[model samples]
Target: MNYRTHIVSDLSEIGQAGWDGLVRAQDKPNPFLSYAFLHALHESGSAAPQTGWQPQYLVLFDGEELAAALPLYVKDHSYGEYVFDWAWADAYQRHGLDYYPKLLSAIPFTPVSGPRLMARDAHARAALVDVLVATQQATEVSSTHLLFPPEEQARQLKEAGFLLRSGVQFHWLNGGYANFEEFLATLEQKKRKNIRAERRKVAQAGVTLRRVRGREATHADWVLFNRCYRNTYRAHHSTPYLNLDFFERIGRDMPDNILLVIAEREGRPIAASLVIHDETTLYGRYWGELEHVPCLHFEAAYYQPLEFCIEQKIAVFEGGAQGEHKMARGFLPTRTWSAHWLAHPSFADAVERFLERESGGIDDYLDELNERTPFRK
Candidate 1:
């Protein structure tokens, strides 16, 4: 089969249907990988050249039909990426090498792991890998990295000679739970009691949570959610990667997949959490509060989403990125993977060695976390 590669600077060229069709064909289609989500990031200027996330999407076609694609970027820095490669960048700088403009295949500001190399078949997937490596070689970029891919895709990338890196994220899995209470029942008494106490604290503060589905959400609701989203970045002394336009776009384009958990005190919305989900999994992505309320974060971010997941029969709830605190609420440590290829041979070898050591430590960490599971034996 003859394959052709195309570097698309704008996603509009591929169109939503063509892009989302490939995504839907995946075994586990994530909302973040949907065309609406990625296009929102690009069109809203959230992930654009000005923001250091210049789109360099890779598309592979077999004759006239699209076979595989990757949501790639030419990154100027590593701020939004959760994989943490600042040290690698520093080492490059120390050696008078450039790390900026590295190729990254990832969903901007979304750390949830899913499929990265979207393909129709295994052969196309392997061909896409070849195209990715070839593109990196042809470009002046220092490296190419695929972040938060599924374990199966990560393995394929490793077989293609990409270095593998391991990281951990917390995810809550449904065990045929009939309801939130049933889920809690599976947890140890102490942990269940702690969760109950936390929920009670939010209630005692008179903060009632109201879940607004994206279709039901209004312009005012988007305004409030964006405010809270910005406040989260402000609290961290960092600028937000997303803007109001991005949120509004996604809300309009993919309403059914979006969930806005709003916390109201005295009938005024004070806190909100934005969650995105497909049929199988709910992803807790962003959360913030305008007013300080005890345990409000936990209620808005974890419990509400967990309850929704149980009600919707969603199989998994990924708590997003790092947070040992999620464990108390029944989230277990799950391994996440990324694949890397360095243009420089020495740097590539060094990163491979570092990943080996990091992988060992990650294994030990997962073991330690498993020993402290909140669920009852």
Candidate 2:
């Protein structure tokens, strides 16, 4: 049994068909994994080496068919990865070791959990895992990390000698809600009242919200969304990881999977949120507002998308990254996983010990979060 390998710097190196075919074969395929979306990230220079995310896509072929593929990158910094490792990097830095240029497999800037290793079967996936380790060793990076991979892949990575780290994000699950009101009705009275109050605040503030599908989103709309996206980052005093070009590319290339919620005041768009969705799930990606309105963020980012989810029967809406506040808005805490492999023995042991303790803390945290569910019993 022989398998061919391709160290793809450009996604087109393996072609869209092969790459997407592998993604489709995976039990969970999302828009972010689709070739168009990833290619856009590369061609637009959003995730380029110059910007710290140098694409190092890995693939394996079995007699002219793609057996496995990993959306790998040589990351110089841990900026876009949602799974934070700044402490680990700092530990290495204090000890005079390089932590940059680490091997990473994740959708850059996107933290929604799903498959990172796209493979036809378990065998191919296992091979991909082995290849990932080989590539890490060959590259001589400090560590190899796969972020937001599903439990199964995380386990596979752990089985192959990787440290598993856990984090939590808020996700709203659909309950066959025929309407937004029906969904809200299931929540505790106080929670339901709070949601209505928030929505009413937006309404009273004369902030009208509209949802635009990507196909219907014009260049002007992209510009508006970009303005809001940048504003959000600026408010945080941080640089926006993605650019207007990346947004436009995805809007052009993967229109069906996009939803842009824009807030209007005096019939002028002031805020916008970008969300990615498939048949069953919606990912809350990015948002920004030019003018702040009370509850406008919730209206544009959370409530509007939840309405879309209810209407479309989308089962899950992942509010990206840490937002314990989301639980108040009906988004419950959910556990997210990342697997890591460190080359340095002492550092690896230290990280392993730390993760063991962290995992237990996460377990307790989840229990506490579950006890605080906003729904009526």
Candidate 3:
């Protein structure tokens, strides 16, 4: 088998078919991890050099066949990645070493957990990692990190000498629910009442929710969506990772993977939630509201998406990123993984030390979260 790596400086080199074909055949496929999805992010300017996520996608080829690929970036700052490394960056600063322009393998602005190392088989997967190590060394990047990979992939990376780091994100899994009521029944009485009241508030306020898909959704829909999208960032006193152009391009190019739940009052959109669905799971992505309607966030982000999942027979709903409040709505804590390789010996030593201590605290926290499960035991 012959091997080569592309800089991913141009979109054409990482052809959509070559990447999507591998994704479709994988056991646990996710649209967020697809070529079309990542490319749309770049082409639409959501994840670009200007936004600190410059494409440095790595691809491995064998003869005329595509063997493996990774979505990588030449990062200047860590804004979109949920995993915080600011302290490490500060440590690099204290030591007068550069951390910017390091190598990263992750879905830009996405914190959802799934596969990162894509390949036809284990041998190829392992070989791909070896290639990335050599590439990073040759390029003299400070380090390379793969965030939120599946457990097996993380283990293999650890075997290849990358230090393993663990984190938790909450997700809701369906367990033979005949309907949403059956799901709500699993929650404790107090929590169940709280959720019911939230949903009820939306209906009482004369708000109706509708879902729009892909090409069917209009540019006006995207325009309204971005307005709501920016509200969340503004509330937090920060800027949103994506812009209107990015949202518009994605909706045009990849409608099959997109799901928008629009909440309207008297036929006008007041709140919206944007989600992505593949074969098995629905990922709850960005959401916001133009109006401060009670329980609007839950109705748009959680209840609405959960209803769509059940109607479509999708197995799981991964509420994006961290939200302990998700527990009250039936989402449970699940372990997530990342693999790190730091070039500076002292910084590497300190990070590994911190990770060792952090893992214990994380384990205990997961145990505590599991003990408080909303589902009936």
Candidate 4:
């Protein structure tokens, strides 16, 4: 039981083989769980201290064999985390307490649920939590939060003394569909027609979409994707978190998980959506269009992904976070959990109370979502 803990201050310090080994054994396989994915975030400057996401990765070793690791960050602000804690921070501000410099265990900007704590065995997983709990106490940070953790890991963290928080995300699951039409068959007839109309608009607009995987994605592809990606943010007057180099790097290093659907008209790439997949599921990450075509977003983002999942026989497709628009496309409401540890006793009590009320609201919201599903009776 001799073990030592190493603080991974930089991405280079964490090796992919050692990290991936632990992750492969997990109950759920989320592409975001890969070390390469998180490393890309730091290496590409998307999740660095300069960007307010200081990596404080924790690694455990039992006499030279890497046992477990957590992709932890000492966050100054919660900008990209899908789990909203702005109000929590504001409450602490009102009470004259600092909430910055909190610890987070997550896949940086991605909100897809997967393993947060990686371990070779159950013992290692439990030990990892112990180490994290100790780190939280010793650092005297405001709190430590693990966002979008898989269900088993969430339960394990709860057993290790972290407060459980719940949220909902819309995900499309494959129901043994032979094709996209079979998938639509489960949906209400009106919803089916709506999806068909959306897909038809792209073809009517003379836009044909093509999907390019990893190494197959070229410089021109990156340029087109970034242009579309940035335009989407710019239209909203915000900047993108990822850079062109990051996309290029991931395309080179991790091609199996990267899928880019590009809509082309007159031999020019117009709208593009980026998706990542593993053995189990496809994650619809980002997309934007240079030219606004009617229902083009739905075709490029939702319909294309749904078709791919059905064709590939992938188990699920997570459409990122917070999209009621996804319901009409057959993406159902699924619960996501995060664990929080607060340092201040008074603030902790206050947050716990607030969470109790928020949880009720979330439950009611999920019920409404289910009731509004476009699925046939």
Structural similarity to truth (TM-score) of each candidate: 0.98, 0.98, 0.96, 0.97
lDDT of 3 by residue, 3-88 (tens): 76555675567577877887876658687877677877887788888887888777777876778777789998888888888888
Q: Each candidate: RMSD to true structure?
A: 1.1, 1.0, 1.5, 1.4
Worst 10 residues of 3 by lDDT: 1-10
**Residue 114, candidate 4: C-alpha displacement in angstroms:** 1.0
Residue 67 displacement (Å), model 4:
0.6
Question: Rank order by TM-score, top first?
Answer: 2, 1, 4, 3
Identify the runs in model 2 with alpha carbons over 4 angstroms from their true place. none
lDDT of each: 0.91, 0.90, 0.85, 0.87
Model 1 C-alpha RMSD to native: 1.1
lDDT tens digits by residue: candidate 1, 246-317: 999999999999999999989898989999998899999998778889889999999999999989999999
Worst 10 residues of 1 by lDDT: 57-66
Better of 1 and 2 by lDDT: 1
Angstrom error at residue 370, model 1 = 1.2
Model 3 earns a TM-score of 0.96
